[model samples]
Target: MKLSYMASLAALFIALPAAAQPSTRPMGPGPMPVFADFDGNGDGRITEQEFIDARSKRIAERASEGRAMRGLSQALDFKEIDTHGDGGLSREEFDANQMRHFQNRPMPPAR
Candidate 1:
């Protein structure tokens, strides 16, 4: 009886974690995965090299999805985004640029 009880307890313990996990993430677009690894050094700032590397990754991902991007335009260059002239892009600057870029893009009419 004790052995059976122990086995049952162990099974329940193993099952609890899987059962407690949420089935799926909430619907709709959440944060982009690109930014998660953008700051490679974890210094809370992105150097030009970091930006270029991350941008390349993003471009590759978009290409694979059949949505190839020609890359950043001359107007919105890295130095342009680095408003502080500190040679590093802060979180605020990155977010603002992303927001502006998305907002200006003309949307395709729905089917």
Candidate 2:
């Protein structure tokens, strides 16, 4: 009975998706900055605070007529994006992150 249960568990594990594995496969070159001017510190990294400040400033600029985002929402969003836990992101980290976003994005019809 114990062996049968173990076999069922093994089969369940084998049926799981492969998405969790980290690939060593190279990602071609990587996306160049869509907006480099935002890196004001010039430290080859974008700190969490800098990212939040820059995003807020840009949103405020475009929203000259009125506010669009709440303070809490912005803070939470920044926290979510700052995944490295280093308080800042190296350029490679940022680029690879952007690539992850693209990879997860839904594909369009091939037409």
Kindly list the per-residue Cα lDDT of model 1 for residues 1-111, writing each as its tens digit. Answer: 999999999999999999999644322222344444678788899899988888778667665555524323523778988989999988888888777776665443343
Candidate with best TM-score = 1
Candidate 2 lDDT over residue span 1-111, tens digit each:
999999999987886656567544422322323335456677777777777677677666546544333332323354455677767777766666566656564433243
Q: What are the per-model numbers of colliding residue pairs? A: 0, 0
Candidate with the greatest lDDT versus the true structure: 1
* Candidate 1, lDDT over the whole model: 0.70
The residue ranges of model 2 lying beyond 4 angstroms of the native Cα positions read 1-35, 65-76, 96-111
- Worst 10-residue lDDT window for candidate 2 reads 26-35
